[model samples]
Target: MTAVHASSESPSETRKFLVLLVGSIGVVYGDIGTSPLYAFREALRPFSDDGVQQQEVIGLISLMVWTLTIIVTFKYVLFLLRADNDGEGGTLSLLALLMKQTGSYMPILFFAGLIGSALFIGDAMITPALSVMSALEGMKLVTPAFTNYVLPLSAAVMVGLFAIQRKGTGAVAKFFGPITVVWFLAMAWGGLIHIGDDWTILQALNPINALWFITHAGWAGLIVLGAVFLTVTGAEALYADLGHFGRKPISVAWFMLVFPALALNYLGQGALVLGHPETIHSPFYLLYPDWALLPMVILATMATIIASQAVITGAFSLARQAVHLGFLPRLLITFTSETNTGQIYVPAVNILLFVGVIVLIFSFGNSESLATAYGISVTGAMVVTTLMSFQYLRSVWGWNTLAAAAVLLPLLVLESVFLAANLFKIHDGGWVPVLLALAIMVIMWTWTRGSRILREKTARNELPLESFIRSFEKSAHPPATVPGMAVFLTSHGDTTPAVLLHNIKHNHVLHQKNVILTVRTSDKPYVSDDHRATITPISDRFSKLELCFGFMEQPNVSKALAICKKRTELKFEIMNTSFYIGRRTLIADPNSDLPRWQDRLYIALSGLGIDPSDHFRLPANRVVEIGEQVAV
Candidate 1:
């Protein structure tokens, strides 16, 4: 399985794992958990000056429910979740699978991966604002005191939530499940209190209201699609995280706990809108009595914090995969715990999220306005996922006519409506994510373009192992100062490796003995320490080293060096060994197969990315970078 893990546990530990798993799931699932606060309310609100229509409310909810049922329940649960490469799932893994299947067309698949990853960046940027803003918007309904102070308060709360992420969420997430449970129960209880008067609105359970609203309302009814888009905002997380809780547990949680809580809360909101009319302005907060509003506001705030955790966690996981697939430059990734499969933190993403979310809160101010940026990225992602699924059926599954059709029916049906609905929202500030997605797409394309060019140039210079071994001993070079060995990192199995070429070109030396270590990461999550490193003897002066790693394996050059020290007779010490890496000059390469625009993109990637000297598992003092000339 490509799924990530700590170890195989005993039966008792497995039981304990269940308890921890549910709790962690709650913390990671906050985005979808708290949608009831604003998803339905916005759906019913007026677009221009016409005001809320009872028919529109029913139509919107119906679409929302079915979207969840088809998109989340069927497409993800029954199909995409099973398409995992090894046990990992994401744009990178998906790209890996596509490349493996379509060898000659790898660049096309990589381009798709670039676009998909770019859309994910846009999603990452918007999720914090939409989720936190949705939660705090309730503060206004609970009490008008929060009006002017809301921006500062929300920013402070979000900053605190993000800052402490390094400490890990294992302890706090234990309460996440229970607290979310209480919030859902509160939603259900409040909704049940008034679901009685709205028995007629129950007619919305039928598809006719949805059909009629679209037919009667014409272009305006089209806008409701964007508003209804809020209900299933986190559905992408369902697919992205399917490997974590497994398809069964998450599906179970959605139906048993999350689904019911949301349905009841939404119905209650509809009931209030129909019965009290006045309270419909903010049905979510109005559900609480005046005396209890303060407490409810606190609960809502907590829910928003939980919701932000999912996106934050997702950003970490997605970023990790991006690095693994070589779509991004290596960044620092830190595991938050030794046990939990889900706990992780990324320094760069954390800072970016904190600053971006706060800026969004201050700019958008309320859920109603921020909602404009929310659905476009989401729908865009959904559209790509659906398109990828069809490709999966043809290329990955090798399905014929009947099976492919059966698989694609719901994916197309559900995503079409979502894509259609989100289209109307463009005028309502929904264009933000589209612009964001395009900008990100450009950046992602640039990084991948630069990386591929460098990889190809390095590959071209690779010498055969036997030839390299013989020539190294003969070439004019500095003799070894000591008997110790140096290990170089290479991505390819066979090539004129970069570090070795750079070492000889600059240092002008050959070691008495050396190992060319090529690190190869399997699609799976963890590899056993025994299978981690393979030694290939080339000659008396050189050896070929292949270090096979899983996603969960720590890439520690020093530690691995020590292991070699213990296993081999050759001396391997941090002090005696020098690490060499290649640095490229980003001159535009228009002659390359990639578009001329991509040449510019590579320059940006070079600027943003860590140098090979830093990314390699070598000490700063011992490391050296040799700059290579290139023409783009």
Candidate 2:
């Protein structure tokens, strides 16, 4: 998972800045960098046979150029990057910031974030299939003999990409910057060589051409916008990876290298189509000499694989955020990098994504077909982000309604148009992503709802902590006191944990020192170590401990308790401590508000979660679980 952690570190020195800038290009720009492979060809598909006219070619290229300029360069790099949450940015991070400024329990805001996250998963599944297929499609230019091998070869490349995820990217990550720098330089060189062929192609630089195309071409123009939307598809990554590389490094990389390279390449492709027309079928590859074709194909394949890696890493991060925020059940999360906590691997997410990509490769069979399924999810996500940004601007940034609308409305309007254009692709394979997003949304919503119901049902039977402690003090028959420390994990700090109640009732003894521990996930990407834990003495033998973690952090109860011991009066030996946890067996109640099927689904999902002791990093030898049945 690639969600960034907050830090108090200052900006890097000049030497360090140069290194981070290159690394940023490799990871942050991979997705947008590879778009030149398929975005242009697919955009002109509706006019393929007729031999696209000069004006239309210029207009489409104009749209491509300015789309990169406006949406990516201006909107993302300049505007949205500034909306970061404590130096971290992404849908979840942004949502977390908004929730902190407001409250954690807003239904409308949560629903919007859930939908955006679901759409991102859909985008994640499609990116690898589309990018790899498009790169391999260049093989036909090498020889017609390679055409039959494209799908199989694409599938293999994707399998290889996902297969390496478990091992982590740290080893090869260093080379990514240098290799991607070469890729961008190659793109710029390829376009510069072709631009001289038809100097008039420079006319596309004028915004008037793009405006004219949109206004005059009617429905075809609208459809073209959807295709053009592909150019900025992965723009979200710039914000998502803000914590990985600071704002300055990513911004410098884009403005200094990435943006210029993409623009030149698109213009070169346009010039090639204008001068040769026949090359439109494979303009990106044919821009190089015959001897360069093989090397170019190799380079393109590598670039696309990197692009896929970015999306997959993003999926891991998003899943962790969802789980931390109570929208999804706990799943296994493994840290892939010893030095970087943000570098993580989620096996379940990896398997699901690999399966989804393989199925897409077989079902769609080609880049053009996969392209139909791509734009909608990304555009949908963009729209959701814009809506959330508006809320942030108004509430967090302290902008008035008019001020917020003034800044956000134009972007929203543009994205809405792009969304409307992509909507026309529903029957032509777009339904694939829609269905994927819908399925994920259902899972998230069900898990969230079921969790709420379970908490409420348990809360009704929960004994208040103070009352229980007072009653025990005044009891005629007090339990025997054992010499040790007991730690009980609970959801509610105000109430006695069921595990504690059950433990004393069954064992007929109370430990000399008791700690009521409640672990909380805060609505932020990272919480500083200084503020991670809070301890309050409730009575002579009892203390209340609240361990707070950021949504991007994994909760480790033992480590947190150790930190508390170092900083506070609390002290306990590891060998003498006992960790008590509650386990619930849920039963479907016909009288409950939820439908019967949903209740069953909730139970099934709850069972799939990881063992609580392992999730909390508790010592298994000292842990005891008390199970009880509850109806929901």
Could you say which candidate leads in TM-score?
2
Model 1 gets an lDDT of 0.70
lDDT of 1 by residue, 239-287 (tens): 7775566656665666677777777777777777777777766778887
lDDT of 2 by residue, 518-568 (tens): 999998778888999988899998999999998888998888878887889
Model 2 segments more than 4 A misplaced: 1-12, 103-105
- Enumerate clash totals for all models, in the order shown: 12, 0
Per-candidate Cα RMSD to the true structure, in Å, reads 4.4, 3.9
Candidate 2, which ten residues in sequence have the lowest lDDT sum? 1-10
* TM-score, predicted candidate 2 vs. hidden true structure: 0.97
After superposition, the stretches of candidate 1 with alpha carbons farther than 4 Å from their true spots are 1-14, 47-56, 104-108, 458-465, 472-482, 498-508, 551-554, 561-577, 583-601, 611-616, 619-632
lDDT of each: 0.70, 0.89
- Count: clashes, candidate 1: 12
In angstroms, give how far residue 206 of model 2 lies from its true place.
Answer: 0.5
Candidate 1 lDDT for residue 61: 62
